[model samples]
Each structure stands twice: as C-alpha cells, then as structure tokens.
Target: MTTAGLSWFTVDAVGAAAPPDTGPLLLDLGDFGSDRTELVGAKAANLARASYAGLPVLPGFVVTTHAAARVRRGEQLPEQALRTRWKQLSGNGTRALIVRSSSVAEDSATSSMAGRFDSVLDVRGWDGFLDAVRQVVGSADAVGSDAPIAVLVQPMSTAQLGGVLFGLDPLTGDRRRLFASVVAGLPEEIVSGAATGTSVVLSRGLGRALETVGPQVPGLTAGLRYRLAALARRTRSVFGSPQDMEWLVDADGVLRLLQSRPVTAAAVPPRHSRPLGTAPIAETFPDALSTLERDLWQRPLDEGIRAALELSGAASRAVLSRPLVHSFGGRLAVDLAAIGAAPGPRRSWLDLIDPRTGLRKLRAAWRIGRLRTAYPMLVEDLVDQVDEQ
Candidate 1:
C-alpha cells in the first residue's frame, strides 16, 4: 500500500523481496558501524547485539532513521495503510506487542536523555499498533529537535513476577548490594512507577539466581553484570559519581537490559556523624555523673540532654532524605531523654531536677540531644568544650 506517493513497506513485503544491501546502509545489530549508520543509534545497535547473541528476543524489525526523517517532514503515513501493513506483519496469533523509542542519543557513552521519550505497550491490533509507532516516530520531531526513533516490535513476555533491579544499593554506594522490587505480574506497571506493595530486597535472592544461571549460560548473567557495572563505572569515572540502572527478568527467567542513567545527587557525602550508644540512658548521658556535681546541677544536665536528643532526631531525618523504600511498618523513632524527663522527680535534693511542668520537659531534653548529635560539626566543638570543663 502507498500513502501519498510513498510506498508503505509491510513486514511481508520486506521479507519476500529481501532488499539487497542497497548501498552501505546498516542492516541490523550485526551491521552496526560508527560511520555508515550513525542515525541507527547506540540503543538500536545494543538491541541488535542482544538479539544476535541468541538471547530470547522477540522477532521484529527496526524502522530505520531514514523512514523516520521522511515522516518528520509532514509526510504522514496513513493509519489505514499502516494498519494494513501491521495486519500482514502480525499474522495470526494472540500476541501483545510493544513499540519503543530507540533514539541514537538514548544510550550513549556520554550524555543520555533517558525517560524523555514515549513507548507504548500491550498493543494488540494493527490499527492501534500503527498509531503507536507513528506517535513515537512523530514525537521525535515535535519541539525536541529531529530525534529520530527506531521502532522495535517485540512480543511481550508473560511474566509471573517482574520488577526492576539496580546493580548497586542507591542508599549506600555499597557495590556488594543489589536492590530490586518484585511485583505479582508483568514488569510494565513497575517500570511505569505505578506499582504498590513492598519492593523485595534482592541481595540474597539475586546472588542465588546469579550463581545458578552464570555457569550454565557462561557469559549470560556475568556478561550482563559486567556490562552494567562497566557502564556504571565508566559513567562515574567520567562524571566522578555513581549511576542508576534499569533491568528486568523475563517469564523464562532470563534477565534483560532495559535502561541505564546517572543517579542524580546519589553521590552526596553524609553531612554529619552517626549517633552513639544503645540504651536510652546511655544515649541521654554518655558520661557518669559526679556526686558533688549531681547535687549542684539542677537544670544544666536537662538542657544538655535536650540538645543531644534533638541532634539524633535530625540525623534520622537526613538519612531518610535519600531515595529508598524502607520495609513497611518499620519504626524509626528516637527519644534520647525519655528516662530523665519522667514525672515526679526530686525524690532527693541530690537528684538532678529540671523542675519543668510535666513529661514535656523530658521530651524536650531528648529532642535537643538528638539534634545535637545529628549535626555533629555544629555541636562537636561545644561538646569538646563541655568535656574539657
């Protein structure tokens, strides 16, 4: 079928005719070259390599940058013509398809415009499929410059459990740690950031999966890990920081690479030192009190106690600022002066007393101490002074 003098090539037509090399045009992942098909881009080249490596990739094709450019110049491919082509390509099967934006600038060694494009999933028929392909191709031209898209049509996998995995723990730059979140079904909902429920921590589970699959596939998991780690390492080496990666495991339990990008502000250093001691009393008073000083000290200790408690609270808040999903129902509360701030104090004249209104006095002391510890530098000098005196 032809739309406005441009012939719309169906998968069947391309398959039947088997267009010759036709100059030095890139054929697929196998034919990728830096010079010949720069427009095919890095992402397309990677997908091509993955397919060639005998990976369980869906059978589909790329709609070259050459075709994308034509569409950008107001030469619209008719939905009817595209539908006709799609029906021929899809054949007879209950298949859910995906149309992704494979731009040259997406997976580059340098900068990347990650998550800035559109991809449609679960498309069933030609009409919807063709429209989706065109939308992605067209989006390349809209306001974002001539961002040509290479459309990849892959058969969606029926997954029992799926989610995303990061090569390293984002919270702490701990390389030994691997973080993942598993949902009940296909990875789409999770990828789109719409999934709920607890995201499973994957260090132990992933370790087992890697140990089992690595030797069998030779370079399967190892290669993926190496490549992802290298990508992250190189990115951090260049920018002097770490990166965040996106990955998935299919229904057949084979891992697939989805995306990788630099993690913003993940490399920021900790602002203060961590809290000290365990028991509530120890936390409140790190040093033992002298009898003479204890009798003389009526409200000074309570004031210092309050300061320390406040510091601890502030520290907890700082740790929570970094992006992370804590296990649900985990308690993170800290009250450093709970014991000292109890009611009915002054049983003995020697007993240190704040003489404040109620339990509020004790709670206030605890918060102050927590905050002081939380911002170490801010109060460290003062602590030293008190210690010396």
Candidate 2:
C-alpha cells in the first residue's frame, strides 16, 4: 500500500490472520475492486479501483454494508475495531475526517444519486466520528430502496482547491471535449449552486484548453490542467466509460481523486426524432420564401439567435454550430428542443418545485426579473424591425 505519507494499509494484511468466522466488516482503501461492489457498494468500489489503477486517491477505508446494516438495526458496533481503524487513518494526530454515504444505488452506472444523501465533513473526536458514521448510514433511507449501504471514511485533506471533472462535455455530450468546474474551496458549494465557479473546456484526450468561461480561478495552473486531463483519460481506460469525477488539490499541490462514477447522462438524445414547431418561426417568416430569399434571410436570423445565445452564455459552441431552424418544402420549423436545452436563465415551474435545484431557483428568478424589466425594450425593437420589413 502506498500511504502517500498517511498510515494506510490493506484489509488483506489483517484479514489474512483473522479467524475465518469473522466476515469483512471494514476494508482498507484500494483493497477491493469491482468484484466486491456488492459488499462495499459502488461508490467505495469505484474509488478503490481508481486507487489501484495508480490514481492519486486519498487514503481511506470503507465500513462495509454488513457493518452499516448492523448500525441500522441498532446492533452494538465493534467499537475496538472502529477505534483501531480510526487511529490508523488519523495517524494519532488531530485531523478532520469526512464520512460519506456509499450505498449500492448511489453512484451506480445508470444513476448517480448526487446530493441526495448525507455526508458529514470536518469531523473530530471519537463521538463525532461515531455520529458521522451513523449519519451517513442513515442517509440510505432517503433512497427509498432497501439497498445495502456502506460508509466511506477518509481523513479530509487540507485542500486549497476542489472541483469536478467530466470526462466528456456534460452540456453538449461531446466526447472529444472535457468539461471542468472548479472553485477555491470544497466543491459542494458549486454542487449546491452556492458558488458559480470557473467553467473550463478542454480537449478530451489532450487536456488542451479550448475555452474558459468566468473569472480566472487561483491555483488552477497549467500542470494541474494536464494532470486533470490525464486522470480523465485513465478513468476511461480503467472503467471502460467516461466518468464524472470529483477531485481536490491538497496544500502540497498534489491532486487527490475524491470520487469517480460513470457519466451516465452524457448520452445525447437522437436528433432525427426531435419534434419541431412552426408557431414563432412561421410568424417571423410568413410566406414560403424563394431560395434567394431564404439565403438572404436565414443568415441574419441565425446570426441574431447565435449572438443572443452567446451573449447570454446559454448555449455551447457545438450547439450554436448546428442550425436551429430547418426548412421542409421551403417551410421553416424551429428546433424548439434546442432552445429549451440551452442553459438559459428562464426555467420551468418544475424547476421551482424540484428540491434538488436548491439555490439555483433564486438565481433563476433574479435573472428572469431582470429580463422582465427589459422586456418592453425588446418588444419595441421587434416592433421597429417588423415595421421596417
């Protein structure tokens, strides 16, 4: 085991000498692979696989599903074993620990139950450790499934920066591009929409940045960019699919792999089957235009829409490159789905009702209020354009 300056060891080292009657209650980080996913759950198993593949994963241990079940049933936990493992992880020093949920349903290949479970961070003292573990284990109830739950415990690193990396473009599902959102502290802020971090786009395999949106973030250096790309490539190679991973940079500038799961939602919807609408576009261009007329009018309309999307940061270049409106028998129909898919400020009432959207609802309402204030000016401009035409 590579401790990386922490006192870490494998479960095999201790389990080999123990009596056969004792089942696996806890396993050290990197000790189990995908085979033990049933016992340790997907989240812990994926982290272990990443560590075994030579990723800079933080040293941690998994309290197995069996142990969590015991806790759930109000059984007396093996206090001695828990204390010994905590000692090894803490290195007998005062350091905060993080206890996170690792249920089988939570980081599966098909669904990533992100932000749905509880994670207790910055834990200290023995009582705090027990409480954090209990909290994580209890969070499994929120899944609404009787799936076995495990708990992952790690000594929280004093990280200078943290963020998430998508091996493929999350918004456009472009496999050749990587999307990164990074912040100065814990990435949970970005996840909760408490902080709108810097968004960066890089070439998937090469990590060469194509564009960056938002302000320049501190500590996101050139070397770190390369390392992040390398990690993405390795994760795809190891997992046989692009992954969505959370990462942190410690005070020493070493990047630590925090979590890894398959990028399930990156699959794009089929383009051919998308239903198109003609209401607004037909109103704009009422008659069937000739080829020359279409050529003259389409460019200006496309340019105008693209300019608005760009100015609002609602759509990506990949989306803008594709034509939003198509002509069938010289009658135009707009790709309404494309506009709806864009990350615009306007959100549906469903967004307001979703508990998961958190602070984003407030942000969206604020943006909508500002847009509403400017609506009259926009209408006046449109009226002037119609009159001139």
On TM-score, the leading prediction is 2
Give the candidate number with the greatest lDDT: 2
Q: lDDT per residue, candidate 2, 264-350, as tens digits?
A: 752433333444567767777888888988888777877777766655555555667888778877777765655663322234588
Segments in model 2 whose C-alpha atoms lie over 4 Å from true places = 1-22, 32-35, 266-389
Residues 236-283 of candidate 1: C-alpha lDDT, one tens digit per residue: 443344444444556666655554444444332133312222254445
> In the order shown, what is each candidate's alpha-carbon RMSD?
16.7, 14.9
Candidate 1 root-mean-square deviation in Å: 16.7
In candidate 1 the C-alpha lDDT for residue 245 amounts to 46
Candidate 1 local lDDT, residue 224? 48
